[model samples]
Target: MDAASVPAPASPGPATAPPGDLAIWFFILAELLAFGVFFAAYAFARAHNVALFDTMQQTLDRQAGALNTVLLISGSACVARAVEAVGRARSATGARWLLAGIACGAGFLVVKGVEYAAKFEAGINLSTNTFYMFYLSLTFFHFMHVILGMVILVALWVKTRQGAYGPADMNGIESGAAYWHMVDLVWIVLFPLVYVMR
Candidate 1:
């Protein structure tokens, strides 16, 4: 082998951190902790009121919960594709994917709104029962998160349309995406826990 013909070994690249700002990760951890506390409280309360919790869980519209699950999953997929597209410098395509994600998030809100309306119409409220109290509070908390996530998505879409995100510039969009994903992940757990757990 000719030494002159041999290529030098490639240098190792810088270590990659989690996508987005460190601040965003801290915020996400805080949000997760809050949700964890809520979940633990629900579990503790249910343990003592197993029969009421089980019966009230059955009264929940499982189909609506399932539909919202699909919507959140689909929205998360769209957001992931948008991030990929932006990484490739396909701003137009990225914006389109973000739009789709926003639509899915909107659909989730609409479905949940309908469910809430029905419950309200049937005279359900926080004072209705122990089950209703937790159900309303927990689901409403998650609903607010979804709203905030959608707002972030809309901002990301606008920036993407203006070509703000790319391989060299991903922090803003990535931070927003990370937050959106947290919202979806919480719902994924909530859906099964509140609707299906027996």
Candidate 2:
């Protein structure tokens, strides 16, 4: 068929990333690197003082950490569902899932705050010991990430309501979801490494 007679192709629906923005990926990579350095330092310190780590680990509130683990995982799952919903052009449904995710993340923050309050009440701080320095620092850092992720999700939720996300234009929502998953993953690793290790 002549070019004039042939029809142009239709683009595929659903976006996989921030279509035109490479900056977010760079930001994500930088964030991951910062966390990676922290984790590596933790491992090094743990290796040099296994006894200290074990004794301190025993003092952690495993129940709270465990609960937070479940909460973050559930939140991640909800975000995943939201991505799927958005993929199907179900913006409202996706926003609903994001709301659920925000709730889960909030639950995590509350539980974590309680845990921190108890620690503070008991006079715990970064100067308490090397283990606690790592504990408070790691967890609090992750806590901040959750807060930031929630903010992103909230923005995405607002955008979705404005019909900004869909299979054909998913970059913003997907990027936000990706960040949330990364936050969840870090907690998954942090919880076990800090709370349950012996």
Candidate 3:
């Protein structure tokens, strides 16, 4: 066969696979549904006790929440950059960007820990009041998700260093970055709902 007459096979990638593992979308959807229910409950509770929600909301550290918001946003952007680098087969650059993203996620955890510590020191617990119940419960739930996302990111970073991803092959990295973006998106909704909304 003439070289010019030979047809090239289609390269399966994000455009074909929806970015990442097909299975992860199930997990992401389940997680999102859970968060949606929680958010609905929060709205219900707030509706029933507007004054209490508003008062307790004030006790929360808006500054810390805001800081975490910025970190997650930045982290998500870095993950995107990392994905792009990986697509280009720039393993070193991709790994570096992933590390930066992981750092941002870790920073969020630290800021959240301090905020929780202060709450605990003040003797605030789920039983403290209704508003506190939702405040702590919701944030803690999202906090756990952040931790899980970081774990995923670290694995992706390691894989990137090993030359496991590229434009022709990126399911693993795409899936991990997708999950991390979900984590960030939830927080974007959460911060406004729990802190900024009255």
Candidate 4:
């Protein structure tokens, strides 16, 4: 063998990091902190006005709340499956899972609309009392989050279809999923407090 035939060792430079993961984590942490404050306020108010809160809770339809809970929980499960599919290098499968998740979210919104209509017809507007005020405010805030989550899920589905998300670059999908889960988590607390914890 000639000296020219000897192979040179590869040199290393700065390592490249995955996109969006750190930013997503930071965003999630900030959102959690804000939600934590809201939850604390909710608990304080409920404790201070237990009798009124109980009266308000009694007016809500527990069955409807339970249905919404199941819907959100199913959506969260679909999101988890989508994450798994992405991890396994199945972008199409992940997209399908995302679509399912989005559908579940839409279903939750539809049910909520029915619940709201019933409440409105029953003279349970936001100004009715403190309980109704909290009910409208909290559920409306959550509904906004649901809309945002649906947008994110649709974006993720589109990206997945376009071959954007995969095992190597799934941070966006994961972040979106995490945000949806947070929304669901908030409702888990809110449903009981606003509708059942009398």
lDDT tens digits, residue span 1-198, model 2: 555886655876665455324667777788889988998899899999999999989888999999999999999999999999999999999999999999999999999999999999999999999999999998899999999999998898899888898897777887888888889878877877889867
Model 1 score (lDDT): 0.95
Instruction: Give the residue spans of candidate 4 off by over 4 A.
Output: 1-20
lDDT of each: 0.95, 0.88, 0.94, 0.85
Question: Native-vs-model 2 lDDT?
Answer: 0.88
**Residue-by-residue lDDT tens digits, candidate 4, 117-192:** 9999987888998777778877888899999999999999999888898887777888888888888988898787
How does each model score on TM-score? 0.93, 0.88, 0.92, 0.86
Error of 4 at 34 (Å): 2.5
Model 4, residue 86: C-alpha shift (Å): 1.2
Residue 189 lDDT in candidate 2: 78
Q: How far is candidate 3 from the true structure (C-alpha RMSD, Å)?
A: 4.0
Residue 52, model 1: Cα distance from true site in angstroms = 0.4
**Residue 105 in candidate 1 has what lDDT?**
98
Ranking the candidates on TM-score from highest down gives: 1, 3, 2, 4
RMSD of each: 5.7, 4.6, 4.0, 6.8
Candidate 2 at residue 3, lDDT?
50
Query: Order of candidates by lDDT, top first?
Result: 1, 3, 2, 4
Task: Tell me the TM-score of model 4.
Answer: 0.86
Clashing pairs in 3: none
Candidate 4 achieves a global lDDT of 0.85
Over the stretch 1-198, how does candidate 3's per-residue lDDT look in tens digits? Answer: 654796655774454447888999999999999999999999999999999999999999999999999999999999999999999989899999999999999999999999999999999999999999999999999999999999999999998999989988888999999999999999999999998998
Please give the lDDT score for candidate 3.
0.94
